[model samples]
Target: MRILYVGDAACLPEDLADYIGDMGDEWKVETVSDGNSAMFAVSNTTVDVIIVGPSLPDLAPPVLLGQIRTLRPETIRIALLQATEMGSTPSIRLIGVAHRLLPLPLASETVLEAIHSLEELRDLLDSPRLRRAIGRVEHLPSPPHLYFALTRALEEDEGNSGDIAQLVSGDPAIAAKVLQLCNSAFFSNGRAITDLRGAVTRLGLATLRDLVLASEVFSMKTGSNVDRAALQQRALLASRLAARILPRTSAELGATAALLADVGLLLPGVRDERQPLDPDGEPDERPGHTEAGAYLMGLWGLPMPIVEAVAFHRQPQRSSLRTFWVPGAVHVATALAGNEPVDEDYLKSLGVLNQLPAWREMAGLMSERIAEDAA
Candidate 1:
């Protein structure tokens, strides 16, 4: 991979050159001090990755990144930011364009690890599809800070629904939505479930966490043409089915993966040029919704299983698991929830084809139950 570094040289580690040299010829590193030189280097050569620092002499990091994106849309953009500059205006703009962000006073090891992780995920997604999908991703919503807080709270031995509800209640909009959804037939069982703690208990922490994330993200596109309601319902159903399909040990991961499976559809420019699948339900060579969603989630620092599951939910066969796992569970659950058929041949290879009938039955029961609840 060829990487171009732009901005103040002091922002990088002192040993960066030595580290790159030890990695051999597979990695090419180049540095330019200003935006003009950086653009010249980019226009002249094919750079796989570009790391830009905030102290550019000629232009700001965001302006340079925007130019780099227009010039080589496929290049991976990484922004380096000081601690104080994290939430500043420039950093916010960088968040919309850059693929990754590394802290200022960059460590050589951290940089190497970041690149390695990207390479592995790229391979899993197939390089061309990964590149194409990521290139078009103009923005990734900021990580759900509330979701992180809730996750940390749950990790405590004393964590309970009440504490989680208290934390969630701080955001009036989200808290109201939680109550509204919990009172709906989908989560309710006839009695009025009015309290946040009770609703959290009913939904389980994993489900509640994802709901908050979905709510926060979908709310961002309130005026867009996207059918947010339909997408949310589909995600909820898929999550429920995934919880049923996966073993208890892996159920949470499976359910979370299913819940956010269609999130890519909400991203700007991701679906602008979507390609339809072929007659046999085979995906086109271009990365579709799955890859798009996975790329965003991955950038947000979500778990690998969740990222992998979302990436391959439409085509679970792309994953190399010999046994049913989160990806397979999510695939089956998402397919069944969306009224698409499960790939029996794929299940057969994992020796789980016999379980399909039972899953379909569960799905049917779920549908009937929801209908009855609605009535």
Candidate 2:
């Protein structure tokens, strides 16, 4: 693993290098005192990850960070901030550009944990063949024409939340995704968001713009091989059910995980297990949809919390998170929705077996809600 550091943190009474010294032979850390050196190193070398600090002497951190994204689209970019910058507007603006932000003085454990999680996720998704295949496809992030039309309507002075909700409600797929997201891990109160307008309000105008314009997870054109309606139906059920699971941790987050959990199913070689002999006779090594979706989400710069759930939902035991949060909720949600089987042994191990009946009851409620919505 190669890491690039773009600032000096000696004034914090801790030397970055000393704190993270020689993570053994597998780890290589490079230091650059300013933005220019950082850019030079990035141009000359293919570093796996880049870390930017607030003390850069040359370019402002945010602008340089955006440039880094343009220069190396695959490189994982992270930003460090002084505690003082926590409430600053500039720091807030950079949040979209940086993959993750860490507050300084950076703890050694925190830094190592971040590095390990990044490497582990990349390893899970490191598929050159699938990526090449996806690259061969042209212009994939195309939302329906109506989504664009809705965006235009919202842009007009006369546009309002009611109009947006009505427009969203007209499309079952987008409307369900948005509602599931609003009610799931992204945002949740005790009340279920039953209408599109309520969902729009929860998501707000800014997030709405990003979803319509920047988000690719929802924009893939439906294919003949994949049943679009059934896929979405399952997503709605799993998400709503997942939202109800582990509400103490976060309902919206769990729902978001379950909603997008099966996204890897959209990838090649991860479908119905009826493989006829391949003409080429080449072995296919693609990971399942959970890892594939998590990888794709990571590449697209989705938040780590969501990515963690998507990646580990298949086998929540694989994740190191102790509490029954994202992984636990998604694992149970997937099972309850019939996307996968529940591992009773695993739940028993975690001492959460008592929660199973409540989850089944919630699944029943979700199905009833879906039926009413269809009506």
Candidate 3:
């Protein structure tokens, strides 16, 4: 694999090059001091990953990264910054560009782990066609009006949860969905959540921001031939189930992963409403919504755990983190709560085959609660 570091030669992850050798992995690391040289190199060579430092001199971070986005959409992008730079204007914009953000003064071990995780996750995609296909997208679709309104509010000097809630309240459908999740068993704080403000407060602003981005983007282009309502209901149900079943710290993350697992179905090359191919069938021939959704989540800079869980939820065996936390919660939720077949062999391998009856019961109860609340 080839990795490019674009920054001052002095600050490049030159030490990381030697560390990569210790791992016994055949990889090459190259550094370019300015955007001009970076662009020149990429135009003539293939690089799997690109790292950009905030200290870049010749071209602005956005300008340099924007060109990379257009030219090497397949290349994973990482933004390296000092802790203080995280809240700067350019930093805020990096949210839309970089796949991952590594704080400076970070250990070489951290960089090593990140690269390995990213490489493994991409390897699990199983479909070269899908990767090439989704790479062509400029950015994952965001609900145009809502996305802009949300971001604009976030940019304001004093923007708070109330402001975001008020903006969200303007759209009844979006407001209703956000509130439903907050009041639901997964995120409920006890009494009741009747207002969008209360919902945002309960979920906290950062989580709400991510939820908006994921849910709104996933909501676009509901397939005309498919049951859009059913699809959405399944997502909410799976999210709630995953949240309930996972540990407290990662509950919301699991919910987000489960919620976005079907995002791939809404993207091109997979929105045909076709039945899922058999679990053991050739992956290239499958609908590949899971892999498709993962690619977008990674591009959106969503955390690796969420992206991995969503990507492999359909076939948990594909993930290396075989512990039954995020991936397991999402897999169980999607299969039991959504209208899909369970991978019995995969479950059995994880020694969770016997646990399905209990999971289905829990998921069934939540499903009924959702129906009653909607009524």
Candidate 4:
């Protein structure tokens, strides 16, 4: 992997060169002092990753990152953000431009770990054609304003269910979807939830936020061949079932992962990519919805666990996971919600086969309730 670091000598990690050297010839690093130099380097050579520091002499970090995005969209962009820079203009702009953000005064270990994760993701995805296709994609969905508002409300000290509900209610369409999902049999308790506050209280802040995000992103693409409404319903149901499968602590993350599992299907060119041809002229296996979705999440700078879970949700055996965690829960919930068979062999390998019956029971109840509602 070739990395281009755009910053002053002061901002670059002193040990970064040594670290890359230790990783062998597979890794290479190049440092440029200003935005002009960074642009020159990117335009001239193949850079797999670009790191922009908070302070740049010529062009601003955000501007430089934006140019990099346009010039080399496939290159992974990481920014070094100062603590005080949070909520600033450039920082806010970086939200869409940078793939990941790390603190300034960078620690080599943290940077290395982030790089390692990307390396692992590349290996797991293992399709240059898909990677380039996702890289060139310009119309990736942006999380709606409602998601940001909900996030801010959650961050406040006195934020509560009423506050969250009120924020959600400001957007009637989103509020209706939230309430609808909350009342679904997959998420519904014994009683109906009429008010937004009641629904928010039942769903919890994180899950509520995920629902809003999902609702708006799904709403963005209309008139496509894909039945987004039906797809959204299945994703929401899978999210609820995933939450049920996992322990309470990881439930919200699991739900988020499950909710966005099929997001790639919504993006243009993801489902339309042509399969690569082998030397023998046979068509090679193409990257599926899981990879395209995972690539999008990663580009959006979502948490790595959520990205990983989405990537491997369909094929858990492809991952190096011996124990059931977020990926496992998402896999089971997605399969169950879609009325597909679970990978019992994979579950048995992880020694979690005994738990399948309870999950199936949960799915069964969901199906029965849906049938009743439809009738």
Candidate 5:
């Protein structure tokens, strides 16, 4: 894997390069101080991954990344940033080009793990068949206004639950959707949810936020006649199950992690066939859905754990860090929702699943919930 790193941040880039190199002997990394040099390096050579800092002295990271995307449509791009930089304009632009955004105060092991996770993304970018399959689908959903409103709310001190709820209820479509969800068996505690305000008040801010995100991702319409509704139901069920299981594990933001884990599947580029380096499902190596989702999340300015949970859910054993159990829970939940049996043999193959005892109960409860909801 050849990585082109663009930034002036000496310590973070050097540390990240070292970590990538340690992950595999074949990993080749080169650093360019500015965006122009980084672009020159990429145009001249084949790079597997490109990592850029949000603030570059010569050129902004997002502008550089946008250029890189045009030049090398197939290359995996990531934005490297300090934690404080998240949600800023530069960060947003970086998110537009890159598939993953990594935070500083860097952990060596986590960096390596993220690099390994890129393998899955690389495989996807290399596929042509999957890209074509995805291309035929049209009208990918847009990000919900609720997400923007929530972020704005989080930014303001006056952004209380009531304010957030009022903001959300301001949109009739969103309000209807909220009422629909609340009335659905997913949340039907035997009472009807008549209003958006009541729905928000009952679900609380956190859960409502999660629901909004999940609804946006799941509502994507590819126009492929692929029964997106069923897929969305499966995804929703899996996410709900994962949320239930995450509390018992060490992960704190389990619901958020689970809900946004597979957003990559919604991207138009993932299925674009015209791109030469696009992923085709070949036997030797293929970019699976999880990898694509991780890459997309990275571009969306989501936190690292959410990205990791998306990328590594299919292969938790590959990750070095074990503090966040989202990937394992999502994996189990996805399998269960798909009506695929998850046994000890299956769990043992994925090391993280075997270590967690909550999986069985969670799976069972998920099954029951799905059945009850259907009924």
Candidate 6:
């Protein structure tokens, strides 16, 4: 795997590069000082991942991320910031935009973990069966116009809740989805959610934004007889589990990170194949559904953490220096939700499972939720 580390801090970038090399003999790492240089390098070469610092002199994190999405959409982009930086409003927005966000005070072990996660993601992307499965799902309705309007409003200095509400109300489908989600078991606020404006007020903008994305993705009526209901059930269960676990972490923006973890898999570009459940099937060399999902999310301008979570859920130990709880939680949640047995040896080899507390707690919670949803 080749990675481009973009940042102004010479020490941090070099340290990250060295860490990647030391952790995995397979990695080919490079470093750049700014977005322009990073962009130049990406255009000239194929990079598996790009890591950027939040405090770049040439470009803000959000702008750099947006440009990367437009230019080298396939390159997985991650942003590095101090733990304190995660709480700022700008940082929060950047978290919404970048592929993954890692806390500073970097350590070699953390860096290796994140890189390994990325490697797992790359492997998943190359899975031929998953790619074919994703191909069958039809394109969901594009809500880009709504997303644009909402994003613009959020960007405005004077943007108010009313403005966001009005924009959301402009699209009846979005409005209906908002109300539906707010009223569903997902929200479970005792009071009924009867109106779009009220739903927006109650859910808040960030949650609303994510919910809108989720609803749009789920609404796609793929004609395939594949277990669409089961997939959705697992996704919802994973999402809710993440939401529940995030508050326990000290990390800021943990909730948002957790909520968007599996979004990569839901993206249009990730190919999902409905194949026979045969363990003896021939291996595929092409990038699989997970990798396709990660690539597509990178294209769609999702925050790096969310993209990484989607891409690396299958293998969390391979990611860069951050112990991202989102992807970890998704792994546990998805397995539990699907009633799939955990392979302890396989997980231990990945190097992330032991870092987590016993899966029994998470697995039990996920099982209960899945059973309730089924009921």
Candidate 4 wrongly placed segments (more than 4 Å):
1-118, 123-128, 135-138, 155-158, 272-287
For each candidate, what is the lDDT?
A: 0.77, 0.65, 0.70, 0.78, 0.63, 0.60
In terms of TM-score, which candidate is strongest? 6
Candidate 2 segments exceeding 4 Å error:
6-22, 30-37, 40-46, 53-63, 80-96, 100-107, 132-227, 241-257, 267-269, 272-287, 294-308, 317-329, 339-364, 368-375
**For residues 280-300, what per-residue lDDT tens digits would candidate 3 score against the true structure?**
866654346777777767666
Give the per-residue lDDT digits (tens) of candidate 5, residues 103-190: 7656656555666666664564345665554444464345566775675565344566667778777766666676777777566787
| Top candidate when judged by lDDT against the true structure | 4
Off-target runs (Cα >4 Å) in candidate 1 are 1-120, 124-138, 222-224, 272-286
TM-score of each predicted structure versus truth: 0.63, 0.61, 0.59, 0.64, 0.60, 0.68
How large an RMSD does model 5 have? 7.8
> How displaced is residue 40 in candidate 4, in Å?
26
**lDDT for model 4, on a 0 to 1 scale?**
0.78
Q: Per-residue lDDT of 1-375 in model 2, one digit per residue for the tens?
A: 688888884523244466556576667778788888888999988987888888677798877888888898668777887878644433333654675666777766666666676666666667676566455445333334654465456435446888777766676776666666565533455579888777668766544543333223445653425655566567657766776675533554566667777776666545332234476877665455576567667665555667877888767777654446667888888777863568777788778989898888888777766566556
lDDT (10s digit) by residue, model 6, range 1-375: 787778856536446666666647878777788888887888887877778876777888778877886787666767787777655543445656565567777665655566665556655555566556555456633434565456566656446677777777887887887677777666645699787667778877766776665566556553434454556555666566666655443222334344444444444443343233446876544444455556556446555666666666565554543333566656555555555555454456656567445556765765665457548
1 or 6, which is superior by TM-score? 6
Q: After superposition, how far is residue 357 of candidate 3 from its true place, in Å?
A: 5.4
lDDT of 1 at 159: 72
Question: Clash totals for all models, in order?
Answer: 0, 4, 0, 0, 13, 32
lDDT digits (tens) for residues 197-257 of candidate 1: 8878777887788778766776764223778888788888888899889877567778788
List ranges where model 6 is wrong by over 4 Å: 1-10, 13-51, 68-78, 86-93, 108-152, 155-158, 226-234, 248-276, 279-299, 315-324, 342-375
Report model 2's TM-score to 2 decimal places. Answer: 0.61
RMSD of each: 11.3, 7.0, 7.0, 8.1, 7.8, 5.6
